[model samples]
Target: MSGDTALVGCDFSSAPSKRKSIVLAFGRLVQDRVVLDRLERLPTLQQFGDWLAAPGPWIGGFDFPFGLPRELVEELGWPTDWLACIRHYCAMPRDEIRARFAAFCDARPAGQKFAHRAFDRLAGSSPSMKWVNPPVAWMLHAALPLVLEAGVDIPGLHAGDPSRVALEAYPGLLARELIGRRSYKNDDRAKHTPERLIARKDIVTALEAGTSRLGLRLKLSHAQRDALAEDASGDALDAVLCLVQAGWAAREGPPRWGLPEALDPLEGWIVSA
Candidate 1:
């Protein structure tokens, strides 16, 4: 990892809007501290794609599944090659995707409906094939094309511009480690409460103290810390969580981006999982 390279952590929405846009935390790693530099919002997919293509000596951690489960792909008879698989999956309409995935689930027994990536259990992530709740499959649908179109390298999965790297990230993984399954955010204003606010503060304090296993402190100005804690939706804070993960990856240096060397190329691994 180059010390001077920019680092980004993104909280992505498949269909971005003014109310829930894609959020990016721009920062850099300085020794053991990941500094919070700024935040940017893209309210449309095109702008998000353009941001991905922006010339970079930068690496980013994006909140979306980069691949489907191998079992799901094989069952659907989609292309098994990573890029080919993504292109095949992306070419489908949303309804078709839902129908097909629904059928896959219907064939399985209760409690074993969604096929999962190997890393899903370790990372405590929803199955990438799941279309509701988190709708990570839809997230994959919306974001992978933009990433592919931007021609950025995806470490274990694909090679593109060497200067720009994108890695799979889940803020929940780090949040769980620090806060222990506590709900720190919600999109619904009615659900936002004092408890969630305290959870956010706890997360920020832990990150600043380098309390998590990643061993990297978060450097934030007073304003930045308040901004991260006070955002009830958690989008900004989630993006910064990813920034911390990206910073950890930068420190680890790559070819693997801190992922295991034996990762299945067709099913991407999350950073620091």
Candidate 2:
């Protein structure tokens, strides 16, 4: 990994619009610390792809699942090769995909409604194939193809632009480390209250203080810090959380772009999960 690679984090929405969409945060890592410099709103995935094409020598932690559950992939008879499986998945109609997944879950017993990737259990994330609630199933359906087509390398998954390595990031992992289930932000205005703002503050304070096991602190102008906390939707903060993971992967993650050597290629691991 290059020492000067830029770091990025994104919070994705499956059906992005100006009202609720993807949020992109990017910055540079210096001296074992990260400084978030910009936040961008991509109202659509096409625009996100356009932004990704701008240029690189960057490592980004995307808040989306990169691969499906190996069990699900096998049961569905999808290709097992990382890139092949993703291409096959991205080619399906959303409705058909939903129907298939629903059928898979319906046949299983309760609590087993979803198939989990190894890293989903490890990261405490919703199953990548889950269509509702967090809707990460749709997120994967919506995002991974773009990541693959962006020509960026996704370690343990696909080979593309070596300088632009994309890693699966879960901000909840970092948030859980900081707040222990204290709710931070919500899309509903009613849910965005003082308590949530304070949780965001505490999470930011700890990041700036280098209190986490990653030992990486954040460098920010007061304005930048405030901006991260003030977004009631938590998208900005989540992006920053992913930024921390990206920084760690660049600095301390395995030589394979912060992924484990023996990682399940068809079920990419989450960075810092």
lDDT for every model? 0.95, 0.87
Q: What does candidate 2 score on TM? A: 0.96
Residues 17-53, candidate 2: write the lDDT tens digits.
9898799888888887898888888999899888777
Q: In candidate 1, which residue pairs get closer than 3 Å at backbone N, Cα or C atoms, i.e. clash?
A: none
- Tens digits of per-residue lDDT for model 1, 1-273: 777799999999999999999999999999999998999999999999998988998989999999999999999999999999999999999999999999999999999999999999999999999999989999999999999999999999999998998999999999999999899999999999999999999999999999999999999999999999999999999999999999989888877779998899999999999
Q: Which stretches of candidate 1 lie over 4 Å from their true place?
A: none
Best candidate according to TM-score: 1
Q: lDDT of candidate 1 vs native?
A: 0.95
C-alpha RMSD between model 2 and the true structure? 1.3
